[model samples]
Target: INEDSYGVDDEEEFHELDMTGRVIANNYRIESKLGAGSFGQVYLCEHVRTHEQWAMKIESHAMNNNPQLSIE
Candidate 1:
């Protein structure tokens, strides 16, 4: 799902605040952003199935080093 689909504003929405506690993809629960660089944002997602969380990173430098930027 697109982040804008949720109607979240950039200024009003802060990654740290949102990452505090929230669920995404109706399955992967957001734990936190492991790190954020020029590439993109990396988040720690928890799999609802096995309750196992993994590091999911998204970048926006398409055609470069990283691609696909994710906002949450």
Candidate 2:
């Protein structure tokens, strides 16, 4: 699910890098933030249906925000 949406890697696996409490795919609810970095951050999330917990990694997508890169 966490591939690359709008240059943001919202979800991956065992490393949900989004670092947010926002729900993804209408399933996982981001519980809290574990850590952060230039690439992304890890998040604690819970499954809405089964009441499961997991760590999700999300990419920061800092590359797209570069000052030099721009679309004409």
What TM value does model 1 have? 0.54
lDDT (tens digit, per residue) of candidate 1 on 2-44: 3432333443233323453566667877788788665546788
Score residue 47 of candidate 1 by CA lDDT: 85
Model 2 agreement with the true structure over 22-49: per-residue lDDT tens digits: 7888999989898865555667899999
Please, what is the whole-model Cα lDDT of each candidate in the order they appear?
A: 0.55, 0.64
Best by lDDT: 2
* Clash tally, candidates in order: 0, 9
User: Highest TM-score among the candidates is held by which one?
Assistant: 2
What lDDT does candidate 2 reach at residue 15? 43
What's model 2's overall lDDT? Answer: 0.64
